[model samples]
Target: MPGHGSNTESMETASAIVSLITASVAIWKTIDAAICSIKNAPARIQHWRAINRLLQTSLSRMEETMKRRKGAGLSISERKHYESIREHLQCFKDDLEDLQHKIASVALPRRFGKRTIPRQVLTALEIKLQEDPHLEKRVDRNIQLFQLSVALLSLLDPAPRTSVRPILTELHALHLQVSDDDDKLRKWKESAHDIAKDAAMREIGFTSSATDRVRVGRQPSINIQPTPQRDFGIDENFNKEELLHKIKVTQDLATRLEEAGMPTIASNFQLDAIKCGEQLREMHDHPLDMAEYVSLEERYILILISCQSYEEASFQIALNRLNDLASKVDDTSRNELFRERQTIGTLYAKLQDINSAIHFLRIALFDGYLKQQDLLAYDAEIRQTSRLLYEVYECSGMWPDLEVTKKRVRDEFGEDPVASSVEISKALGWCEKKGFTVSERDRQLYFNPLTNENGRTSLHEAALDPKMDMDVLRYLMLPEYYSLRDDSGDTALLLAADRSNYNVVEMLLTIPYLVHVRDRIRRQTPLHRCKDKRTLDLLIEAATRRNSIPPGTDWEPVDINSADCSQRTALHLACQQGRVDLVETLVAHNANVNATCLTGETPLVLACWAADTAKPALEAIVRELVSHGATWEQKFPVRRDPRKRLKARGFSNSDISELTRQPGSSTESSEVEKDASILMHLDS
Candidate 1:
């Protein structure tokens, strides 16, 4: 009985604290809601700053409370409640930080602060609030937790008149305010719903009457009577009309939000509308004609894609509905049926069901051709399907099947033989190099394509495979082929480098002219992409062919520390990718481990920040950098404590030439100085 009494007392105290915290959070949320609706730009920002200040105060208060309660003989539940409160406070603080950043970016007009926050920014904030459920959910949680805590406290505290009165009063006030807001929202939603429904009905009625003639005949009707209502776990008070109205209002709101640069918020509202629409369609007594039902299913698919709602259950439902609709269409409408199948395939692909995806896409091609006499007529459709299938094969690493698809696609679309022939030859060479069976048709084409504008030549594709054969590559060894740059300016060597295909890199290195070639878009060389030790070594060896310079010829070797458009060196990439072996190899080859990217992220900083970097591996890499004379004290001078060290010290933006200064000045020293000057200007 004594232990029971003590437990009761503990719970009561916890409940009181929870209730107080809940009331405070609700007030915070109320202010946030007001800020969301504020029209004046400067006033809204001022309110956000005030709210941010409040959050910081709340966070500090919670931290102090936590420290005071460290050994305060609290129950497990009480401790948990305290921890939850602290977490919610911190989350609010973080969200406010983001909100402040978003607000700061919008330019306010020179006119007096009388103008409403730019219409666009207001709309964006509205959408942001709608899309992110965290604000609403957090408030709701706080209310529930506080209410529960208050109840517990009331049970334990006998002197409730003094101990619980203020807490109860605050909580009641918050509850009333929240309920009032809900009522206003519901009323607005209902009005919007009615207007949308009227407009939609008028349009649908006109379209239906014009396109379809009613047949006067005796209709077969089922005499089935209604049984008990099917629950489907839906709310008993759920109104069909209300849901319809909400869907319309939410969709319109989302569209406006999206147009105003609040895609995330818009997406959330669209998702909400879709969920409502789905429920409306699934109601047992809902009246939808077959065509209308099919259209609704298609709409669901579109909305899901719009919202990026890639959850498997939603996709599965859409796929099932599409399949059901496809089953009803006759052979005369096989094109429609093909589209449904293709949609199903694409959805399956998104779900990572590769076999099912391939099966459905193949069915689309076959059924459209066989049933609708659509073979060459739908060649474009088939080609598109083939492209998706090829991507799936490549992603799933079904290399043989990828080769087969390539051959089949080129052969089937015979209208463009010249282009298809070149593609087929290239594909064949890649397949031969990778030891995937090359089609017999491809063997006849002896020469490679003259130009690779689209970036899919045989050598480039083959170089992506780690096991590419020397014999297959011999066919592409002509001087022109060896030196060829694709549309992206990527040579075979660059492709090999990016993939860490060691064997392929070794073979490609035979072509001396390809060693230092950079891609067109990023201007990244083979070294920039290489993250494997052996592949990097091969690239470094090719770049540093001192013997090729011929004694005292005065030609400098290639710059191993060459930077890409982003100023990222091979060391930066290696460190970023957590490639310890490559990192070591690159440093050994005189790669600048201290090199800073455009963002001022050094190799040490990158290695530390890499999401996948293992603790032991990171330690080893950091140790390697330190051994090679990296001094974080000069660049990232932070406190000795590990936790303090891990806190993001802002960008170093150190002098680049000094950061990457070599022991011996090279011919490219001028370029480094230019880069350093540009960086300084940018920094200033």
Candidate 2:
């Protein structure tokens, strides 16, 4: 039994030994796993540190390069350097991605139950990256990326308290740098704006010169300085006082001399009066009322005597002076002074100083002191004055001033002053009115006021009379009245042309705005109205003055080829007038010598029908017309009766064939001949 018991115990001890060895092997594996996990922690941390270092270096280089780029002007070489740096940063980014992939692929420690790397290790890497100067410089930009994996890991594991504070501190530092840089950049931009504005102001001719000061946001200032006074034979201040005293003494002596009426002293008085008058005349010329009333009276007296001079120019000067003095006088004194002023003005008008006459008359007309009856009593005188003024205005071509005087007279008198007349000899021995007249003399209208019908004034019968005075027409052509059309829709230009008044036509055509005016028909232009050669020549002169003409106007002569109502051109009329020279002139102007009348008759046909005595003229015109491409059919052939048809010429077959070929004519040759014959008879 003991032996058996020994065997059982030996077996049990062996089994126990086997179980202990197995437990020993299992513990060895557990220690090995714990050691392996601990060993991988530092290695993994080192890899994270390397990644952090790489990221920090890359970001720092990028930030530094950007700052350098902003502060310094970059050359091509520097830009190339930056490109290389950007490539390096991209490589760094790849490296980081690779590191992340590698870290993600790492097997979690078995003891940690499939969790990733510890949050503490990731936090350590992020905190180290934040402390790195490179990453610190761009913390705000890099922080989110830096913390991405780490923060995710932290959700799985607790984050390190030490790492969080440092990350926030680094982030704050980066924000402050970005803000400071932004503020500096903003200030620089503001300064640049101010500089640009100032440069713009300087370029626009706004300069700072004393004489031409540029006052911004203020009223313009003017600099005024007193004229320097010169001493005349006395101390400066003392001379002024002494001069005043002497003037007072002279005045007292003059008064005594005037009251005593002494013969010996009278010469001194006269001499003093002459001196005062001369000074007064000087004042009148300048029209300075700064002098006292006594000085003005002396000036008026001087003006009166000067006006009395027989010299035309001297009298004009004196008359102007009197007018100026009258303008300065008060209303109460105007009527009392009217006679003297009127005398001066009337003399001025006689001297051809119409400007002065008009000036004085305007004042008198508007003056309240003059009664309407008194003005009416002087109506003849006023009309005479206006006539003289109109004559002067006509001569001087001062239409604007003339219009002003006319308007003033119309406003005050409600009538044209030039139209009034005085009775002359009675008609046939009957009484007639005396005024400016348009009369006929030597087969031409003359502007002699002494004649019968020719002496009619323009205003008296301008609208009613057909024959106008040449001078009156010239006056009407003045700018003030050039646009005035008479009752017949005839302006001064048209009237002058109709009258064959060459001088009047010449004057009318000189007006700038009258050149293109058409008559009531809207067809007869001023150029179209001329009838006589002299009048036509005047039109040519006016047209040449400004070189103004329609695109194809022919000024060689009155183009009788020019057509009017009834298709009668100037050439047709010239032919009818038997004006052969005028016809030649018209032909030279490229006038359509073949131009047809409404009935299709040419100027040649008209001349042919007019008279056999005009046969030579008719032949010349026909030859010119044919040379200018006039159709032969425009003339007629001999008729059957030969005498009766001589007056009513017939057409030939050749003429019929030519007429058949003309535009819009497709009839048979016999029908064309019949039509041509009909047209010819209608023209005749």
Candidate 3:
């Protein structure tokens, strides 16, 4: 009877094993089919890998469980428990397969009318898939499977399943989600119980009182204070006084922080100051007395100026508010309005809004409240405003406006104004004639503003000249003067790069400050203006020399990756101008190969854009950038169209396929061939 029973048990075990293997194979085939369906999608690749890892783990566990149970002659209860665990595993497999199908469906492209689903839909799907909601469900299923295995093992064996304990512990640790309120309650209870115990011990031998019974069963009492109310108008009056005081304190603090080079912290304080100023205005029902109005304008102007560095948008908004306030002022306060308009014009000029700059400057110049007697007293204002007007007029080639501005200058100041002021004479190049002593000429030009209409200081004129005066450059090469910009906002270094003055550029290299100074027009560093390889080499060498500080020093290195207003780095400019040597030089100096411009053009994209015209040189540049790890990811917006941006400043429908074409493939070459054909047509 015992031999017969053993044979039956062996036969039953083999049959069960065969059934489990058949089910396992079916589950795997389902998973594989699901994976194959989604394999075409780049976004679904990670999900497939995750699912693979999960199934791989489940297969390993199932195989191990079967191996352990193979020779073991399980009783009826143990066999039933084993079957239950196997059934749970089968359920987990089905759910996992279902999840794979759901994910695969997400990867399948959707068609709406003639056009496919928009990229935004694909992006949303990618994000949704990446979040892996199904993975959490898989983990939960894992926990259930682990629990079932544990329960089955406990029924079959007397010892704990030590192998899975670590996994279970890890899962528990990962999934533990305690609330902040729960944590606080736990801490409070411990503290309260300790205090109650201490009180009971202290009163052990004393007579028990109603309040001294420890009160361990009752909740701790907390007293809440009632806030006293004041009259609305009086409260507002108090707040108005307090708000002004707060604004002053906050402004001072922000200034101190900014001076300490903590601009981010200073911005926080500035926001608070502006908030207080707004509240003060609100307290008076938004209608200010003349004195309060003037004070508020002054406060907002200071806020606008102080916040200009890091909060430019806020500063622009503040300028708008100040302009609105100025319009409300009567003619008696017209002088204040004029000053406000002048401030706005100056800010607009600094921000490179030339049209607005011209508009407000003209208003500040021609329409102030100064009477004929007081006009001479405001002579400095008239000259300064007229000078700015003349500069802009010259830059924009407004010849009629230039003549009008020249007349305005002579009418406002005196005729021969350049000769009357020694500083102005030197700034206008009047002192550059053969007779003046070098020291005297330098001194005269020292305090002159580079934007002065009178021909700017000889430094700017010499810097732009192809055959530059080396002696004059060395004489005026003081560090303080190196960053001075002309009317067009081109510094001496920028002028050299603009005109490709290699010799003048070499002279300016000794002063490190000149190399990093950005011109106000485009906020471009000198390196940004380099259109040739030789000039770029000179600038790079200068930058390296400047940055080669000894270890442990407090000097900041030159930012080779520093971007202009358009966010084009030095590398972007070098590649755009088709200087391969400069591109390689910039890359060697650690310029980001993947640095993008405002229009999402990488050095590679820019290089590729010109592949039709300058194929060999640009192809070499493209190859160099790729080897340096340049990617095709567009980091900035070019347009609403999904097509890649071209160098021609226009989009072509065929360019999209060309951009997305596989690099080094015949398709890529064909696109370039087509591009060449298109170019020929356009040129003709």
Candidate 4:
């Protein structure tokens, strides 16, 4: 008792597993002792017995799993969890044992070979428990912890071997019933008409009617009321989460049973859950708001999906009912019908029923409007709907439809990336949460190479966005994606560097040797394409940390001075067109500034050609490269003076024959040396 709840942190997982089982057996024996000691055990006695047995059985199921999991080796967090459970169970064992000892001390007259505890002893104990609110709360908390521990038995196992869910539901109902029984017993004990009033007959071994007495001959029965089924009914303003949670709970059971190879038994449970949703639907006969209507219908739709993978009958029934309900409301309730279309269409899309998705989305967007031709008439929701539908189209390779959605939002809705980012928030998750469960098949869409123009994964595209967190990226990674190039000849990292997206460059560099992954045409490494010094440093640092390339990958780790096919390194790209800060950072990191490209141009030659064309920062960039030990002197350097032996034509540009990509490749205006350059001319 002195160390009632102490030293749990010192306990190990194996010790916890042993101690928990010991404490569980102790608690069971204590409950049984308490049950045996009652002279005229109340109706609540059987409830306590049920709960005690349930806990014992639940603990037994957990024991094997806990041992197996422990054998598999516990993580630090797992060890701590079991230790805490051990400490709690030990404390619960102490509490129940204390109560049992108190009951045991109450010596009463012997009856049927057992010493009974008087009703007054239990009454006093109950009163003591009542005086301390925390004690009762402690018991409930222990039960909940036990519930959670049993729940853990199913941790990675496909099915839970334990019936903890339905058992807990029954335990909860029984607890309330027992609590009410206690209140009744307490009330009666306070009255003059309790066991104390019937004490004279106790000498002759007469038992109280508080329990069902076994008679010598026939059982007495009058008309009996049949027990009622589980009440799944609702009152006004019912808890939506509670009612709807039935879908998850029942489906959970069915899934477990199926996992246990009892699919025939499992199949009925989803149908049972759908039937409950139908009951919930019936209860919502009164008028409802749009959010409520959407919420209920969404749950109902999920119920249909759960019942049968694509049970056409249920879908048609819900569709007809919704249409009938819409008709009853008005010829046109735009908000209602639009949301219904969005909800159902999203389900079809998520279900990968592309044709149905496109059809319903068209109805949601254009059907209600008289001017269906004009996208300007549609609202922001239509834009959201269009985006969702476009994903479906894109998934199915329906390029024309995807283009139409994109064009509609852009041309009519004024969906500029910069402007529309602020205007469009994500649609409420009525649909997002409803689809795409994780499986290898579902993951195939993500990890598989897309057959379309961008060729499938937009991960390359996502990497270019400054805001995207590429850390969760490994979940979407496949071996092919490691070197996968988009249609534009960019690996995800190449795109990051091209854009000078510093954060994305930093993230991509974390993949060993992936920092060196190059684009197809320029064969330019990320280091080659990058313009900023921070990106340069990131790539250089990443190069040193390379490991053995992942198995099955032909990717070779690159040197810090590695060049693209044109033989230009990151330093070469930096000197000519890069900012003064970019040149300074590359130099500080010990970049090889004297390195020449395939065109025989040094960093100093390019810098000189780029400098003092009365160019302000250009002269500074040229000076920075030379100052960083770039010997364009070939030990002596010259400026825009073309009279030098080397004509240095490409110096104004990146010396393209030995070129690493300069920052702007796509746009000619941004490309500094887009035109064919004249050889540096000598003048008299």
lDDT of 4: 0.49
What is the full ranking by TM-score, best candidate first? Answer: 3, 1, 4, 2
In terms of TM-score, how similar is model 2 to the real structure?
A: 0.27
Q: Which stretches of candidate 2 lie over 4 Å from their true place?
A: 1-474, 478-480, 512-529, 541-562, 627-629, 633-684
Clash count for candidate 1 is 2
Question: Arrange candidates by lDDT, highest first: which order?
Answer: 3, 1, 4, 2
- What number of clashing residue pairs does each candidate have, in the order they appear? 2, 17, 0, 5
Q: Alpha-carbon error at 118 in model 3, in Å?
A: 28
2 against 4, candidate with superior TM-score: 4
Clashes of 4: 5
Give the residue spans of candidate 4 off by over 4 A. 1-453, 469-480, 611-614, 635-684
- Error (Å) of candidate 1 at residue 527 is 14
* Candidate 3 minimal-lDDT segment of 10 residues: 217-226
Stretches of candidate 1 exceeding 4 Å from the true structure: 1-268, 279-336, 374-379, 397-635, 638-684
**Where does the lowest 10-residue lDDT sum fall in candidate 2?**
422-431
TM-score for each of the candidates: 0.32, 0.27, 0.37, 0.29
Q: Between 1 and 4, whose lDDT is larger?
A: 1
lDDT tens readout by residue for model 3, 1-684: 333443344345545644664566576666555445443466344444344433444444445555544544443333334444444455555655555445445444365334333333344345555666555444344433443343224223323222222222222222332222543223322332232222222233122322212223221111113244555643445566676687788677656654433333445566666666666656555433455555545554555544433333555766676566545543444444666566656655544456876877777776772333576677776656665665555434467876776666566555523224444444335334522233344133353343334445556766767865553454454434455556787777788887778888876664443575677777887778877667876786556432233334223344678888999898887777777877876765457877767777777666655534364566556555643435443334444222343434353545434443322221232233222222212212
Q: For model 4, what is the alpha-carbon lDDT of residue 272?
A: 59
For candidate 1, the C-alpha RMSD (Å) to the true structure equals: 25.0
Q: For residues 505-566, what per-residue lDDT tens digits would candidate 2 score against the true structure?
A: 55454442344445565346555566676666555434323222333322222222335567
